[model samples]
Target: MKSAMMEREGFAALVLRLRSEGISDINLLTAVEQTPRSRFVAHHLAEHAYSSRTIPIECGSFLEGADLAVRLLHRLRIGAGQRVLEIGTGSGFMTAVLGRIVERVISVERYKTLVEEAQTRLDQFSIRNVILRQGDGSNGLPGEGTFDRIIATAAFPAIPKTFTEQLVHNGILMCPVMVDDERCVMVRLTRTGSRFEREDLFEVPYLPLTPHIASYL
Candidate 1:
């Protein structure tokens, strides 16, 4: 009814804003439009889901802004047939969106509670292509095999060798890394044989990627 229509309008506005901000991929924009962002956030903060601002989720983590997520995904050049590995599950908002764009997604989160909650949301959306794992994302699921595209939602001091090793040939890894004490910049590493081509995208305000599984939320 009226509420559903408002939600549609909000998503439409969000898509428009994203396009203006340099998100040219039509499939990426459609994925963002179709994913119900409110369902991935707390009920009280659902109204702000469409806003380009970070929202706090469980386990003391925050969901990156929708715009930033879209921009990163766009830069990754994710294809429909590629398998994607995501480092931080966070609120599962990006996970859900990734599920729509890629062929399959394996997402790892340090917090068990977040994984469970994210699973529930993914189930609600009928997103069957995403598998949620509760583990240290810094390790990047080494035993599961390499992926076509790997993305880390958090910042790292430097790209982890484990992550780079988990990328298949010609695969891309997008992540934010600390450039200095006060700054973090998004970087793209493309694996080619024994070398990884590095490209720094832009400055971002992402939290540092942590190690080890959380003992408690």
Candidate 2:
């Protein structure tokens, strides 16, 4: 077993790295530390889990690093007792972090194999509040009801109407939207009484969010 002091030191280093990147939420950082990125990454790449690098998963999808996840969650401002809808459940790392701070998480994935793997990863950590579903995540989960916050792990050519309609009044949706063929920007959409306001956060690179179930393994 690793020494308690070593764990603390490692966690503190992670917190510092995230803080330097402008991820100021202490709760989010703690959740990231507790989730341990190493647990969700492939065995060969486990050593670099905490670094801000995208890693491949079972399918063609790449797991967004802790830095991206932290930025998305911080902008969402997830709070206790709130329901969150996550667009991609890659490796279930983000799902686990949101589960720690939110009442519930409804994560949708396009690949069945990825869904199963992500579910197993969450089970390993004993995280029970995330509802992992296999389907196209471009359209948010309707049956689960409107969410207080929604985060998309993949990039979309445009904000889908379905997501805006499913967001509760005063709810926020954070996602990376493709501005051109090659450029993407993280945006925040807030819904208030049928009106939605948009704010662009920053530029980011991510795979396109597909509407069809993935055929590629």
Best by lDDT: 1
Worst 10 residues of 1 by lDDT: 1-10
Instruction: Give the root-mean-square deviation of each candidate in angstroms.
Output: 1.5, 2.1
Give the TM-score of each candidate. Answer: 0.94, 0.91
- Using alpha carbons, what is the TM-score of model 1? 0.94
Clashes (candidate 1): 0
Model 2 C-alpha lDDT per residue in residues 22-84, reported as the tens digit of each score: 777878887877887777777787756666678887777777765676777788999899999
Number of the top TM-score candidate: 1
Please write out the lDDT profile of model 1 over residues 7-89, one tens digit for every residue: 68778877788778767787887787777787778888877777878888888888777777788888898988899999989
Per-model lDDT = 0.87, 0.83
User: What C-alpha lDDT, on a 0 to 100 scale, does residue 144 get in candidate 2?
Assistant: 74
What is the lDDT, from 0 to 100, of the residue 120 in candidate 1? 92
Off by over 4 Å in 2: 1-10
The pairs that clash in candidate 2 are none
